[model samples]
Target chain A: MDHFILMDAGLGNFVVFVVGPIFVGFVIGALYLIIKSIVVIRRELKNEKASDNENNEQIK
Target chain B: MEILIYLIEGCIGAGMLFIAVKFTILIESPIIISGGVTENKKYIASINSITNVIFNVVLVFISFYKWPVSSILWYIIAEFLLIPFSEILAYRAISKASVKQIIKITYCANLLSFVAGSLFVFILIALLGLF
Candidate 1:
């Protein structure tokens, strides 16, 4: 029983050490990209609206 | 010794962040910007974001492949704090913020994240030793 417990602990640690960082990194990277996309879309919308307003003023 | 270790880790964290930011600015941002003015902004943004996410994931995997201490919780905390930096950079890129302003903001964010992340890592490593 003691040997089994030790083996399990070692395996768990190995998995965490090998896999955890990659998983975390991937999550952070995806998040950054998604946020960047939102910013770009919002800015584009603002610019479009500004252009539209300028066009209306010219017509008037 | 602890302080020295912390200081070195902090600098490493900061350098890593700066490099990531620079990579995003120079490579990923350009691809997103290549969409012409007449293109649907929403569509472009969606595609760009998806593509960039994929790119970043690959980069991250490579970065952490052989790195020490794969503590997910600590990494998550550090990254969550760093998320705002990327968001701010993205906003600035889209708004065409002055280059100097962008650089300043990036530097400040990098510094902040480095300190926070380094401290977190230090505590985490110590805690791991206890376990």
Candidate 2:
């Protein structure tokens, strides 16, 4: 079973093979989430403010 | 054959994260006025982290069908690193920075880290003569 996975894998191989991908995955994933969260927040705030103004005018 | 499999697994997992983030941003674009900007960013960041953990767990399951305990353990450890990264970016985004500037900075950061990780992996593979 070990031979099937890697002809000769050690701690180093496991580090690069298993941990490496997860590291890269998180890097991109976090960025995507960050930008996304920002965009969503800004857009939502803008819309909410706009609606609030409309409601105020309606109340008047 | 095994090397290619690992490479593909990494790519798929990364791609899945990208798409999941995009989908989340799109679906939650409208604000419900529950809190201030900073508060909202924190909520969104927390949500993203949750989804990311679940996503990574599923990816690990699919990638390693026979799930060696060591491999799964290492993967989980790596996934935890995302929490800090996400929080840092969230703080930056909610700071006084403009959207364009924040996006550019985060994009460069992500690209640089990805390239660095890939290069390190390749160097290790070359050194070990695994490929």
Candidate 2 lDDT over A1-60, as tens digits, reads 977667556767878888787667666555655566557656755665687689899999
**What tens-digit string does per-residue lDDT give for candidate 2 at B64-113?**
66556755555455434553355346646444455555444444434443
Give me the runs in candidate 1 sitting further than 4 Å from their true place: A1-60, B1-60, B63-92
Off by over 4 Å in 2: A1-9, B1-7, B11-131
Poorest 10 consecutive residues by lDDT, candidate 1 chain B: B30-39
For every candidate, how close is chain A to the native chain A in TM-score?
0.70, 0.75
Residues B37-109 of candidate 1 have per-residue lDDT tens digits of 1234453444335443544455456556655344454345434444435544544534444656555554454
Query: What is the C-alpha local distance difference test score of each model?
Result: 0.52, 0.54
For model 1, what is the error of residue A44's alpha carbon versus the real structure, in angstroms, after optimal superposition?
A: 5.9
- Provide chain B TM-scores across all predictions: 0.35, 0.37
Sorted into a CAPRI-style docking class, model 1 comes out as: incorrect
